[model samples]
Each structure stands twice: as C-alpha cells, then as structure tokens.
Target: MTVISTGVYPIDKLLNGGIEKDIITSFYGPAASGKTNIAIISSYNISRTGKKVIYIDTEGGFSFERLKQISKEDFDNVMKNILIYKPVSFLEQRKSIFLAYDYIKNNSNSIGLLVIDSISMLYRLEKGDEDVNEVNTELARQLQVFSEINRKYNIPVIVTNQVYSLLDQRDKIGIVGGDLIKYWSKCLIELKVYENGVREAILKRHRYLPEGLSIKFKIINDGIIEYKE
Candidate 1:
C-alpha cells in the first residue's frame, strides 16, 4: 500500500489509513506544537519497512534520541534505513533536495519517504536579507523540485512548516510560503497546543477526508498517542 501508518492511530485514521504517497503532506503549527514529533514518528514508521527515509532537517529538529525511544529495541535496524541531511541555509536546503533526488534514483526502491522537517526555517531566515519576490520564487522552486520527485518517484514528500499570524486577521494562522506551500501540499494538518503536553491536529485540507476534523494527541517519550481525558 502506498499509504503508510503514521504510528498515531488518530492521525492514521484521519488520513484514511495514513499518509498517501506521490504527494506533499504538510504539518504546520506554532512552536512546541508537536510538528517535529509527527515527522519523527512518521520517519520511524517508514524505516520499520526496511526502506530508506530521506530526512532533510532545516531546523536541526531531527532527534536520534526520540527515534530511539520510539523504536525501542529496533533502534539500530531502523536507523540504518533513515538518511539524514542537515542544511543550514535556504540554498543548502535546495542542494540537499537535489542530492536526495539523486540518492533515491541511484538506490532505486530503497527509499520510501522524503521528509523536510520544518521546510520553512531556512527560508524564514533568508527572507529579511533577500528580495521578497526573489526569496518567494526560490522557495516555490524548491517545492517544485519536490513535486517533480513526487510524480517521478512516487514517493511521499512530508514537510513541516512554521506558522505566522495573519496581519489583518490576528486570530488566523498562515504558513510560511503561503499559497506556494498550499499549492504543493495535497494534505494539510494544523497542530494546536493545549494545556500540558497535549496537542490537537486538525485536518485542514485533504483529498478525501472531511475538513475541520480534529484529534487530540500527546507526545510522550516513546511516541505520540491519542489523548484521552
């Protein structure tokens, strides 16, 4: 099946058996909203199949300790199938994506998923120094590469994004890259923080699922699980 379970029951169910392949799936929210946790858990799940997961960490949020905790005794084996690339700049992020594409093509059938954990971090950093239009164009170009990879390789591209409050609408949250990210992502999930370590994931957009459906989950040391009151 192209759909892979995210290891979180509620999220898997919400995604109709899990994240779909050959498209972009985005998770975005405020800081500490469990965005990175979801990405890590998804990577762990994909690695369990003995398939490589190309993880591009733009925010240095990829955690080996968290993966070990989630994998338990299978940590060593799971780690083998996950390839990580840390890019410190937006330009490097672009290069990493290209390298990832080449690596996947050469390996052939070895990779199952591609993840850019907080894909917007480096771009966010570059926004102030670079021309607004130029930076936006570059960001869109990066996403276009992923889109091409998605279509050509039939691999799922998962990205996490940082959120910003809208200027006129202070209550509403918008993702970095705005329409560009939305255009590429077939599934969009908004994470919300509640009391304690609890968080909510709302299915904001999807190909088949109904929108506005939400599930509360908690990030424990081992992994994420459905939260209950």
Candidate 2:
C-alpha cells in the first residue's frame, strides 16, 4: 500500500503520510460539512501532479471556484485534466461506474485517479428507507464492482459518503450505509461540525491510526482549509 500525501499537513501526519493508493478512502459526514470541499481540493492536487483524474459528481459538489483555493496558479490544464461527469438520476449514477471502468480499461495510460463525489446518493435513492434486503442485494453488487476497480487499476479511488440520522436519541452520529458501507470501505473518515466554527476530522477506520484519532480543520469559502487551531 502506497500512502500519498493528502496535502493537508496535520491530516497527512495523522495518516502516517497519507491515504494509501489502489483502494477506496471514503469520507462521510452531514450536508455542508466540508466533504465536497476536501474532495475538490484532493482531486486538484492529484491532477496537478500529472494524473488524469476522472471525477464523478453526484450531488453537484464539485466547483472550479473551490479548486482555486488550493492553488492560485493558472489552472488551464488542471481543470482539463479532470474529466467531470454529473449523473442526474440514481440509475444514471450507477451506470457511471461502468462508464468510468470502461474508460480506464481502454485508456489505461490516461487514467491516474478516480473520485465519486457521493456514494450515498446511489444507496439512499435505491433504498429510500432502511431496506436491508435491497441494500444487501443491490448495494453489495455496486460496491463489489468498484472494489474490483480499486484492486485492479492500482489507482486510488476517493469516495465521498453521506452521513445519516441515527434512529436512537443518543449523541452518536453515523454515516448512511449501515454495516454494508462501513464494511466495504477500506478507510473511513468522519468530519465533526462544532458550534464554535471548529471542524474536526477523525481517522476512524484506518490501518495507520491507533483506532480513533482526530485532527482539527476549518471550512472557509475556499473550502476545507486545515487549521490546527
């Protein structure tokens, strides 16, 4: 496993360098919790490094205005290097998996990184309610396809997941996919939104971390700027 720099100082340090390549690193959190910001920034950095990135946007989470935050330099090639595809419906989103898969399969030399803005949209839309049977049947098949791509391509896949509401009234917050999503994801990152303008990201499930360790961050108009404060 190759750990590449996330480009965030404290975050990189926390991951013992960065997230490993050739696997899926899923980041899950609520709406407007800076999840999309990090995705755009990460994609920018990866693409800037001469990697042909395929970004699949599900919830209109990607933006060039946000990309300028990481690097103010001319983004003529960076933006072009990234092939963004927006899938309007749930079925359309699922089809993009194979579309991206085929593109990479044929144009092996052109692909370097792949990102799905939100995986939750597929699961939620398909199974609007807590239908475990539907998820296990359809969701399992969906993840299996991507999992194959992750292992086969040897290129890193960054998937942004959506957080869900907990059934109980406890203080515990959770992501959308019950055990299936949790089990399928190789890396799990949780972002916390505090009342005092403090955003903290926890490296919950990772081979490099000591179970549950976290690093602080803040969200600005630019995006999720890492500030250790």
Compare the candidates by lDDT and give the number of the best one: 1
For residues 1-229, could you state the per-residue lDDT of candidate 1 as single tens digits?
4787877777897788898888899999999998888889889898998889999999889888888899999999999999999999989998999899888788858888899998899999999888989999989888998888888888889999999998899689889889999998999999999898889999999987899998999888878888978
TM-score of 1: 0.96
Note the residue pairs that clash in candidate 2. Answer: none
lDDT of 1 at 193: 93
Tell me the lDDT of candidate 2.
0.76
Candidate 1 residue-wise lDDT at 130: 88
Against the reference, the lDDT scores of all candidates come to 0.89, 0.76
After TM-score superposition, what is the CA distance of residue 26 in candidate 2 from its true location, in Å? 0.9
| Model 2 lDDT tens row, 179-203 | 7777778888887788767777788
Q: TM-score each candidate.
A: 0.96, 0.90
